[model samples]
Target: MKVLLIGPAGSGKSLLTRSLGEWLRRGGYSVALVNLDPACGYLPYKPDFDIRSFYDIRKIMRKEKLGPNAAVIRVHELLSNNLEKILPELKIERDFILIDTSGQMELFVFRETGPKIVEALKDAVGIFLVDATLMNPIDLVTLKLMAQVVRLRLNVPVVPVITKVDLVPEINFANSAQLTREIRKQKGSVVDLALALNKSLDGFDIPVRVIKISSKTCEGFGELLSTLYETYCECGDLT
Candidate 1:
């Protein structure tokens, strides 16, 4: 089973990738962690297969006379074109495979590269990280919007997670419907967009769970593990 970790920068996906891999390994499951960030300067855990081995955006920027933004775009386009090459490195069989994505959300998810990566993986579920300490009406609405984008664009199951729960006393994931109603009652273009996304998602009954986890305290990792295993089993990815 493959689990894709995606979110904005500083969303703790790297930490969660390391933590979840340890949890799975402790449970007697083989785990392989993949770092899909070509430009990552540092990673907390060593990856089994890192995109840097194939393409490092920083090196390309220096050698090809490209700017930071252009270098990232070109690198993603390269990854998209050479996705087949990545397959050979990812052929190791494991009970769980955790994918740590790039921090460039738009370059990865909002574009063609995200879907291409998802299509390359079998029975993979996305874990979208939302910073718990930054939860507000606007942030929540924006998160819902991005989450919908992942579901619609990638056409796979997405689990919305709240990272850094150690900083917050409580995080609410169940109130999204009510939050949408409140947003609709208000008058604004952003709220209007949020309301529309809520309605569209409601019709599809897409399961967007709000999991609160903290790598500091190991909070909610157990629930996350159970949930992931259940999801994989439901996908008929049984060993």
Candidate 2:
């Protein structure tokens, strides 16, 4: 299965990509890593397919005389246009294909390139990482909303994962009711907004399964792998 690791900057998407890929390989599963971030300087694991070979953001800035933001936009534009070139490489047979996206999440997730790439991959599942350190009830609600938006855009199954759990004391709430109660304790209009948003999200199949993982300790790798397997097969076969 093709799994896309997507999240905001500093959300540990790349680190999770490395950790998850390593975990899968150790289980004797064939895994392929694809780096789609042209702007990323370093990665823990070398990608089997790297977008920098096709278009580098820094080089685009230097050659095209564009600013960093403009370079990022331009590189993604190039990627969208050149999907045919990249798609072939991604189509190689493997037990798992892990794709690490750009740190500039909005540029990718909110734009056309992300959906286009996900559509091309067919059965790709998105792993939306949220930094656990930012997991106050209000912030968690907002991040959950963002993950829904990502699912809507990508039109695929998405798993919301809390990353960097080691940095946080503990996840505050187990369910939406607990989350709402915690949100009610906070002050300001933002709390009201979070509460209303949380209510509006009711009845929709939002990801409620908590998969808190720490790439540092490999705390939840087994659960993550199992979740992915369940997504891939209704029978939840890991074999």
TM-scores of the candidates in the order shown: 0.85, 0.90
Best by lDDT: 2
Q: Write the per-residue lDDT of candidate 2 for residues 1-239, one digit (tens) a residue.
A: 88999999999989888888888899999999999888888898989989888886777899999987678778888877888887787787999999999888887888887788778778887788989987888887777687678888988767778889899857867478888899999998898899888887755644345577999989988988887666656423323
Q: How close is candidate 2 to the true structure, as a TM-score?
A: 0.90
Local distance difference test scores for all models: 0.77, 0.81
User: Mind giving the per-residue lDDT tens digits that candidate 1 earns over 1-239?
Assistant: 78889898889989989988887798899999999877778998989988888887878999999987678778778877887887878887998889998876776788777788778776687788888888865566677667767867886667777789899866554366666756756766777777777666556554544667887778888877776665556545323
lDDT of 2: 0.81
**Candidate number achieving the greatest TM-score relative to the actual structure:** 2
Instruction: For model 2, state the Cα shift of residue 27 in Å.
Output: 1.6
Off by over 4 Å in 2: 231-239
| Residue 40 Cα positional deviation in candidate 2, in Å, after optimal superposition | 0.8
Give the local distance difference test score of model 1: 0.77
* Candidate 2: residue 55 lDDT (0-100): 86
